[model samples]
Target: MRYFIHLAYDGTAYSGWQVQPGVPTVQEALNTALSNVLRQSVRTQGSGRTDAGVHASHQVAHFEADFPPEMTLDLLRYRLNRALPPDVQVFRIHEVDERANARFSAEARTYEYFVRLRPDPFRRDQALYLDRGRPDVGAMNVAASYLVGQFDFTAFSKVKGAETHYICCLYEAGWHETAEGLVFRIRANRFVRGMVRLVVGTLLDVGRGKLTPLEFQQVLHRQQRIAASGAAPAKGLYLSRVEYPAGIVPAADVREPA
Candidate 1:
């Protein structure tokens, strides 16, 4: 049977979500633990591949197992956590349909990038610190509004393979200030590599008076990644949530925001 696992991780130590031959990755760790628990070579798939130093509040993965039939849900979770490194944790697991996919089956993904104006000891790894003067939050919001629709995000993504189109439906994107920091939340049907970081970086330029909201729109229309400023630090980006169809069995729901 197929199983889905809800997970969260501190990406500070991982290369990313996908498994690479020599690099330590979240997927690799999970596979190793699952394989060890099932007493067979178990493989899994993740919802998305986040960049190095990026974190996730809610990430999901799927695996298939048929050997060592004695394994139970509680036992698998316990053994997996004990076998996996401290940086990654699996909170819940349930048997899912064979058709479930961690990536293709997802309906929406939400990400948040945080920027802080003050020193935060508790959030050093989760938020970006800007020592400069205050940013124009109003202007930044106006610029973010222009990105809320189906559009080609080539201007905001690293130039990747052309096999798939760069178009995506951005449901929500905006900036807000809190005592903790400036929170930038973006929800979309899909995302291109480096898309979120680039959007946040360029919007920061708008907040700092370097780019007008109209100019930001022009950048999007240009369809060139180099037209944008730069990608924000990977440390501040988080996969906050992933929404799936109602009947599908949900994972642990740990680390992911509601």
Candidate 2:
């Protein structure tokens, strides 16, 4: 049976989400645990890759297991969790169709970069403390508005594979401020490598008055990475959610049991 696993993890102390040759990775750890539990080699495909030190609140992956017809979702989740590392947790599992793919089938993916003006021990790893002078939230929002809609995001991504184009549809992009910090929310049909980090960095520059909002639009139009903002640290970025088509998988399979 093919099982879809919904999980979340603190990406500290690991290379990234994809399996690497020697360095530890979330996919490697998951494949190891699943392989151990099933007593056979198992591989998984993640919804998307998150960089080192990134975090995910809702990441998805699918794996195949050939078991005696007696396997239950509960049993698989239990065994996988028991064998997996503490930093990564499998929240739930659902039996999915053999044709389902965690990444290709995704409709939308959302990410957030959290920046706090003050230090908080509880959120140190999960958030970035950017006390580099209070930024102008209004200016940041204005610049973020330019990020909405389809555009050549070549200026944002770092690693551009031949198969992956830098053109992505930005469904929603904005910044919100709270008492403690600011959050940059971005939802897109797809993302290019280092897209979010670079966007955050440019927005920060806008807030700091280093870049004007109109100039930010010009940067997007320039279609050059060197023309735009800095890529922020990976720690502040989180894969907040992923959207899939209805009936692709049962809703119960998308999250962990309370």
Candidate 3:
């Protein structure tokens, strides 16, 4: 049967979501734990990859498994969580249609970038420190507004990306003030490689008076990679959510009794 696994991870300790040679990764940890618990070789596929040092609050992966008749989904989740490391967690496991996929079935993805105006020891690994000065939130929002609607985001994507095209539709994009600092949230139909970090980096330019809002819009229209500023630190970003169509999977719950 096909199953969807809802999970999250703190990416500070691992490479990226995908498995790699020698380097530790979230996928490698998950595959190993699943294999150990199932008592059989198991390979799971993720919804998408988050770069090294990036975090995910919600991620989904799908796999096919044949459990012993006595095993329940809740029991399987508990066992899998026990086998996984502390930094990684499995929140829910349930059966899904064989056609549902963690990646292609997703309708939208949202990412957030955090910046701190003052230093805080606890948030050092989770937010970027910008003690220089508070950025111009007004200017940043003006620049970010251009991101809404469809645009060929070639200017913001990695030059060597494997994607066939650079077109993406943005449902929403904006920066807002938070009690601790500022948060940038963007939701899109799809994203290109290094797209979020790069966008955050360049938008900071506008925030810091380096680029005017109009200039920022012009630069995006130019669609040249070098026209943007350097990419932001990976630690400041998070894959906050992945949305799917209704009935894609069962409703969310803490867990079922085994």
Candidate 4:
């Protein structure tokens, strides 16, 4: 049977979501823990890859397992959590159709980057501290508006040979001031490597008066990586959500008895 695992992880201790050689990674840990609990080799495909030190609030992965009819998803979820490390967690599991892929089936993804104007020792690892001066929130929003439609994002992506097309349909893009900090949220049908971080960094530049909103739009049209600002720190970015079509998996309220 095929199962979809709902999970979240603190990226501080691991290299990234994907498996890497000779290093700790979220995928490696989850694979090992699932294998240990199932007593068989288990490999999973995540919805997407997050760079080192990037966190995820709601990520999904799918794996196939052949289990006795007596076994249940609740038992599997409980066992997987117990075997996994404290930083990595499996919250729920649902049996899905064989054709429901965790990555390719996703409809949209949302990401947020957090920034704090005041220095806070507690949030050093979760948010970026910008003490230079307050950025013009209005201008940043204006710049973000320019990114709300489809365009070539080569200026923001980090990988070169891996992508065949640079076009992405950005559904929403904007920044807002929260009580705790400044937050930038963007939703898109897809993203390229390092896309969100670079977008945030460049928007910060607009806030700081380094780049005008018009200049930012020009950068997008140029389709050159060097035309954009450097990517923001990985620690400040989070994969906040992933959306799929209705009926792709069982409803959240549906659960097997524990």
Report the number of the highest-TM-score candidate: 3
Candidate 3 per-residue lDDT over residues 10-80, each given as its tens digit = 89999999999999999999999998899888999998999999988888899998998878999999998
Compute the lDDT of residue 108 as modeled in candidate 4: 91
TM-scores, all candidates, are 0.94, 0.94, 0.96, 0.95
On a 0 to 1 TM-score scale, where does candidate 3 land against the true structure? Answer: 0.96
Report model 2's TM-score to 2 decimal places. Answer: 0.94
- Residue 55 in candidate 3 has what lDDT? 88
For each candidate in the order shown, give its overall lDDT on alpha carbons.
Answer: 0.88, 0.86, 0.90, 0.89
**Model 3: how far is 223 from its true place, Å?**
1.0
Q: Which candidate is the best by lDDT?
A: 3
- Superposed by TM-score, candidate 1 places the C-alpha of residue 159 at a distance from the truth, in angstroms, of 2.0
Off by over 4 Å in 3: 253-258
- Please give the distance, in angstroms, between residue 38's alpha carbon in candidate 2 and its true position after superposition: 1.5
lDDT for each residue of candidate 4 in 195-245, tens digit (9 for 90 to 100): 999999999999999999999999999999999999899998888788888
lDDT of 2 by residue, 138-237 (tens): 9889888998999999988785554356899999999888787888899999998888999999889998999999999999999898898678888899
| Residue 164 lDDT, candidate 4, scale 0-100 | 85
Q: Put down candidate 1 lDDT per residue, 1-258, tens digits, no spaces.
A: 988888889898899898999998888998998888788999988998988889988899988888466778888899889998988898888887899898888999999998889988887888899989788999999999999999999999887644288999999999978877689999999999889999999999999999999999999999987899988898899998888887675443423454
| Pick by TM-score: 2 or 4, better one | 4
